[model samples]
Target: MSGLNDRILGLGLLVLAVAYGWVAQQWPEPFGGSEGLGPETFPTILSVVLVIGSLYLMVKPDADAQWPWGKTALELLVAVIVLVIYALLLEPLGFVISTTLVVGTLSWRMGASPGKAFLTGLISAVVVFGLFNYGLSLSLPAGLLEIN
Candidate 1:
C-alpha cells in the first residue's frame, strides 16, 4: 500500500518536475550573452533535483510508511496554506515582510516561541534579501519597501 502511494506521488512529482523544467527553459535570454547564471538556472537545477528524487521514490519506497493523522495532517495543511498565502502576498508585502510572515508562522507552529520565531524570521529575511539583492544581483520585489 505504501509502495503504491509512493509510486503515485512520485509520478505526480515527476510530471511537475518535467513541466517546471520546460517552463524554466522558456525564460528569455539574459541581456549580456549569458555570461553568468540566468533566472532559469536555479529552476532548472531544482527541477532536475526533483526529478531525481521522484525517480528514487518510485524505485524504492518505504514499506512501513504511515500517513499523517489528526493534528499532524492539520499542521501540514496549515503549512501549505501559509505557503500559498505567502506567494499571493509576496508582490504586495515585499520579500522581507512576506518571508518573515511565512517563516515566523511556520516556526511558531513548529514549537518555537513567538518572539524567537519572529526574530529569526526577521533576521533570515533580511539576510536573504541582502544576499539576493546585492550579492546575487537578483532583485526581489520591494513592494511596500520600495526605496524609490
Candidate 2:
C-alpha cells in the first residue's frame, strides 16, 4: 500500500513537473533577443529536478511508510487548504499580506504563538519583498497597497 501511494504521488508530481517545464518554455524571448538567465531558467531547472526526484520515488519507495490518520491528516488537509487559499488571495491581497497570513497560519500550526507567528511572517515578507523588488529588480504586485 505504501509503495502504491509513493508511485501514485510520484506520477502526479511527474505530470506537474512536465506541465511546469512546458509552461516555462512558453515564455517569450526577452527584448534584444534571448540572453543569459531569462525568466524561464529557474522554473525550468526546478521542474527538471522535480522530474528526477519523482522518478526516483516511483522507482524506489520507502519500505516502512505510514499514512497519517485522524488529527495529523486533518492538519495536513488544513495546511493544503490554507496554501490554496493563499494562492487565490495573493493577487488581490498582494504578496506581503497574503504571505503574512499564510506564514502566520503555518507557523502557528507548527507551535509558535499567534503574535510571534504573525510578526515573523511580517518580517519575512518584508525582507523577501525587498530582496525581490529592490535587489533582484523584479516587481511583485502591489495590489491594495500600491503606492501610486
Candidate 3:
C-alpha cells in the first residue's frame, strides 16, 4: 500500500512537472531582444528539478515512511484558508494588516502563543513591506492606511 502510494505521488509529480515545463516553454517572450531570463526560466528550471526529484523518490522511496494523511489534510486546509483570507484582505486592509492577520491566525492554528504569533506576524509584515515596497520601490496599495 505504501509503495503504491509512493508510485502514485511520484507519477503525479512527474505529470505536474511536465505540464509546468510545457506551459513555461509555450509562454511568448517579449518582442524586443530577450532580456535577462524570461518569467518562464525559473519555472522551467523548477519543473526539471521536480521531475528529477520525483524520479529519485520513485526509485528509492524510504521504507519507513508513514503517510500522515489526516494531519497533512488538516494543515493543508488551514494553510489554504489563511491564503484565501490574505488574498481577500490584501486590497482592502493593505499589506501590513492583512499579512499580520493571516500570519497570526496561521501561527495560532499551528499552536503558537497569541503574543508570540502577533509579534512574529507584525515583524514579518513589516520586513516584507520594507523589502518590497520601500527597498524595491514597488508600489503596493496602502489601502486604508495613510501612506507615509
Candidate 4:
C-alpha cells in the first residue's frame, strides 16, 4: 500500500511538472532581457528538477513510507491552498503583499509567532523584490505597489 501510495503521488507530481513546464514555456520573451536567461528560466529549471525527482520517486517507491494523517495532512493541504491563492492574488496584491501573506501564513503554521512571522514575510518580500527588481535586472509585477 505504501509503495502504491508513493507511485500515485509520483505520477501526480510528474503530471504537475509537465503542466508547469509547458506554462513556463508559454511566457512571452522579455524585451531586452538578459541574453541567455529570460523570465521563464527559473520556472523551467524548477519544472525540470520536479520532473527528475518525480521520475525517481516513481521508479523507486519507498516500501515503508507512510502517508501523513490528521493534522499533518491538513497542514500540507493548507500549504497547497496558500500557494494557489498566492498565485491568484499576485497581480492584484503585488509581489510584496502576496509573498508576505503566503510566507507569513506558512511561517505561522510552522510555529512562528504571528507578529514575527509577518515581519519575516515583510522583510523577505522586500529583499526578494529588490533582488529581482534590481540585482537580477528583472521586473516583478508591481501591481498595487506601482509608483507613478
Candidate 5:
C-alpha cells in the first residue's frame, strides 16, 4: 500500500515538475536585456530538482512508511489551511504580517509557547523581508506597512 502511494505521489510530482518547468520557460524576458540570472532561473532549477526527486521516489519507495491519522492528520490539514490563507493575505497584509501569522500558528501547533512562537515568527519574517528587500534588491510588497 505504501509503495503504491509513493508511486502515485511520484507520478503527480513528476507531472507538476514538468508543468512548472514549462510555465517558468513562458515567463517574459526582463527589460533592458537578459542578465546571467533571470526570473525563471530559480523555478527552472527547482523543477529540475523535483523531477529528479520524483523519479527516485518512483524507483525506490520506503516500504515502512506510515500515513498520519486522526489528530496528526488534522494538524496537517490545519497547516495547509494556514498556508493557503497566508498566500491569500500576503499582498494585502504585507509579507511580514502574513508570514508571522502562518509561522507563529505552525510553531504553536508544534507545541511551542504562544509568546515564543510569535516572537520567532516576527524575527524570522523581519529578517527574511530585510534580506530580500535590502540585501537582494528584490522588493517584497509592503502593503499596510508601505511608506509614502
Candidate 6:
C-alpha cells in the first residue's frame, strides 16, 4: 500500500514537473539579456530538477517509509479552510487581526502551546507588516485600520 502510494505521488510530481516545464518554456522572455538567463530560465531548471527528483524517488522508495495519509489529509484540509477564512475576513478584519488569527490557529493545529502560538502569531504579523510596509516600502492595504 505504501509503495503504491509512493509510486503514485512520484508519478504525480513528474507530471506536475513536465506541465510546469512546458508552461515555463512557453512564457515570453521580454527581458532577454546578452549573457544572463531570463526569468523563465530558473523555473525551467527547477522543473527539470523536480522531474529528476521524482524519477529518483520512483526508482528508490525507502522500504521503511510510512505515509501518514490520514493525518496529512486532515492537516491539508484544515490549512485550506484556514486560508479561505483568512482571505474572506482579510479586508474587514484587517491584516494584523486576520494574520494573527490565521497564524495562531495554524500553530495550535501544529501542536504549539496556545500562549506561545498567540505570541508568535502576533510577533510574526508585526514583523511581516514592518518588513513589507516600512522596510520594503510596499503598499499593503491598511484595511480597517486605515488612519485618516
The total of clashing pairs for model 3 equals 0
Candidate 4 — which residues are off by over 4 angstroms?
A: 32-34
Q: Per-residue CA lDDT of candidate 2, range 1-148, in tens?
A: 6588889889999999999999999999887896776778778999999999999999999867899999999999999999999999999999999999999999999899999999999999989989878865567877778887
lDDT of model 4 at position 123: 96
Alpha-carbon lDDT, every model: 0.93, 0.91, 0.83, 0.92, 0.91, 0.82
TM-scores of the models, in the given order?
A: 0.95, 0.89, 0.61, 0.85, 0.89, 0.56
In model 4, which residue pairs have backbone atoms overlapping below 3 Å?
A: none
| Number of the predicted model whose lDDT against the real structure is largest | 1
Q: Is candidate 2 or 6 superior in lDDT?
A: 2
Error of 4 at 58 (Å): 1.2
Error of 5 at 65 (Å): 2.3
Worst 10 residues of 6 by lDDT: 30-39
Q: For candidate 2, what's the RMSD?
A: 1.8
lDDT minimum window of 10 residues, candidate 3: 132-141
Model 4, span 1-148: residue lDDT tens:
5588878889999999999999999998787654577778878999999999999999999999877999999999999999999999999999999999999999999999999999999999999999988876778888899999
Instruction: Report the C-alpha lDDT of model 3 over 1-148, residue by residue, as the tens digit.
Output: 4566677788899999999999998988756767666657668989999999889778867766775689888898889988987898899999888888888888977889999998889999889988767665555667778566
Which portions of model 5 show Cα errors greater than 4 Å?
none
Candidate 4 local distance difference test against the native = 0.92
Model 6, 1-148: lDDT tens per residue?
5466667779999999999999988866555433345546667889999999999878887667775589898898999999999999988877887898999999999999999998899899888878767765544557777898
lDDT of 5 by residue, 31-143 (tens): 88977767787789999999999999999988887899999999999999999999999999999998889999999999999999999999999999998777655678787
Best by TM-score: 1
